[model samples]
Target: MDAGLKLRGIVAGYGQGDILRGLDLDVPAGQITCLIGPNGSGKSTVLRVISGLLAPRAGQVRLAGRNVTGWSPWAMLDGGVAHVPQERSLFPAMSVWDNVLMGAYINADRDAVARRATDIAQRFPLVARRRRDLAGSLSGGEQKTVEIARSMMLDPPVLCFDEPSIGLEPRARRTIFGILAELRRDGRTVLLVEQNARSGLAVADNGAVLDAGIVRLAAPASQLLDSPDVGRLYLGAS
Candidate 1:
């Protein structure tokens, strides 16, 4: 399969020390790849590097066959990579519609933004249903739905999500996973960093186990789920 995104020899960290050590990864096009690991395993850091939140001290980041290493967040977005961070980025005082519209901030074409907004509203009914409501008024799941919808404003080819199902109810998590499946069906390459290893692998086409900032294991999601080594090492099974 062709890779939608590639990371080679990635070495990055914060402040003084490094967290990622010669990390390498490949996210295949038109599929979902989940990264799972113990806390401090550099899973989130990988997303940051891919989304341009952090620059790799070494290594390359390629998107759609183009080298995008060290690109700024805005540049990455413009280059077809959309990141939906773990934190809630919506404005509490803003209406849901306005919050969704913010996704097109980089776009100067008003007519295009309007057309995308309408398409997004249709795709994520919650955005249209709560169009007049304050973003803060919605539930956690609703907010996440809006976030994903907003991400589609640019119709990016690559989407990276960090802990998307974090702090959500079981039903909400399922909803989020369902959306992930839908995105895959839409032919978007998705890189997911999730703490819920089982659920993450369940929704993923491929799974990578990150340990000590490097890929320890990479395989089909089903294979990883059934692997005794994966169970003992990360899935907490005996």
Candidate 2:
């Protein structure tokens, strides 16, 4: 669960303008760290930087105390950084079992992938019940769970999730967050980017408030939840 992925003075954006301007933050090792912000606050950019999906114009990304600012996607995975993107990352045409197996393509051991699948099936009820079903046939929440289960196929130490609660009913969202809470309890480092501040922070040990591509505030989840400013600006609880 120890991750040393660091971002210092990172400047990144697509095409026209910069989304993250000199942003700096660290995903706590062996803890659940949630990133919250309004739309286009560079929340997703942070995940991309950690997963090596985007190269910073400046600054560094260190893992386990090693500089890996601009490593490729495969390099990041090899270094214990697994990123679950916001989009539907699973293969709709493939069976649930096959999708999970894809998580370990870099690993050469056939038995290892098989062993991981068994564990995944046990950890997630959806995978166990629908192992032979087409991944695309599942509901939104089920797909998210499968995505998470697939991520575990590698047993990554530091896993980053981008809006894992994107599209789902209230009930489904609760289930997904429940799974994440359990993961944190197991001493895994989880970096979650979620727009649902109230629920996201509820499961997080620490919460970082990102604004305009910068860290505006960082605090314990409980403390931040009670902050009047956070409630008004973030939770809209006024």
Candidate 3:
């Protein structure tokens, strides 16, 4: 598969200290690419750069062969990039249906948004099941499904997820991973940053190990999964 998003010699940081130092990586299109690493490894920072939340101090950000370095979030969204942030981004007071429709807010055509919402609702029954309930009232797993369903409103080609399975029960995590697999089957490019290396690699077509802001290994998911070093470091192998 081709790269949907590419980072070349990326350098970014908050203060004088650079968290990502000359990092280089590619998220392949139409497949799930999981980024696994320890805390403070600049994993989330990479997502921020791709989503236009943080401007890289150096290097380039490319999407679908277009240069999008330093583009605003709106610009990125217009270029078919959808970012599902790590934090709870839904409006708690709004109904689940309303929250899902919020993803279509960028478009001016109200009717088109509604039409798309209908399609999304059909794809995710959870949206219809809890359409009348407040977004905050749902369980964690349900909220995740709603969030993912909202992302589909734009029909984006690329989807970026940050720690998607965080703070969820085993069943919820399984549900989330299954959703990711379904996305892959739909031919969407998925860039996933996951703390659970084992689970992440299990669902990904490609896996890259990041440490101290740079990629230490990039290979097929199976290869990485079979690596003894990787298993010992991240997979909790004895």
Candidate 4:
């Protein structure tokens, strides 16, 4: 598989110390690549670098074979990389339709934004059903669904998700995972940082285990899921 996003020898951190110490990762095109690791393993930091929330101290970030290191968040978005953070990004007081429209903020053409909004609403019925409802009025899963729909405003080729299912219930978690599978089917390259390793890998084509800011293990999702050592160390198996 061709690499949709690539990180080579990444070294980044906050203040004085480094979190990602020479990390290397490749997110393949048109597939879901799940990153699973213990807390403080630089999982979220990786997403930050990819989405330009944090610039790496060293190394390179490549998107579709183009060097994009140190680009701003807006530039990254324009370059077809959309990031959905773990925290809820909606304006609680705003209507769902309004929140979705906010995704097209960078687009100058009103007609194009309107057409994309319509297409996204159709793709995510929750957006249409709650078009007039305040974003805070929706359930956790519903809110997440809207967030994803909004991210599609640009029809990006690469999406980076940071623990998308973190606060949801079991059914909602399933729904989010289903949506992730759908994104893969739509030919989007996804880089997922998931705390729920089992569910994440269940929907992913590849899995990488992060430890001490670098990839400790990289393999097919099925192989990682079936590995007894992996189960004990990362998957929380007894």
lDDT of 1 by residue, 16-111 (tens): 889999999999999999999999999999999999999999999988788999999999999888999999888989999999999999999999
Question: Which parts of model 2 are misplaced by more than 4 Å?
Answer: none
Residue 23, candidate 2: how far off, in angstroms?
0.8
Candidate 3 — which pairs collide?
A: none
Stretch of 10 with least lDDT, candidate 4: 1-10
RMSD of candidates 1 onward, in order: 1.2, 1.2, 1.2, 1.2
Off by over 4 Å in 3: 1-3
TM-score of each: 0.98, 0.96, 0.98, 0.98
Cα RMSD for candidate 2? 1.2
Candidate 3, run of 10 with poorest lDDT: 1-10
lDDT of 2 by residue, 55-86 (tens): 88877877878898889999999888888999
Q: Compared with the true structure, what per-residue lDDT tens digits does model 3 show for residues 31-94?
A: 9999999999999999999989999999999998889999999999878889898888889999
TM-score of 2: 0.96
Off by over 4 Å in 1: 1-3
Error of 4 at 200 (Å): 0.3
Candidate 4 pairs with clashing backbones? none
Clashes of 1: 0
Question: Residue 43 error for model 1, in Å?
Answer: 0.7
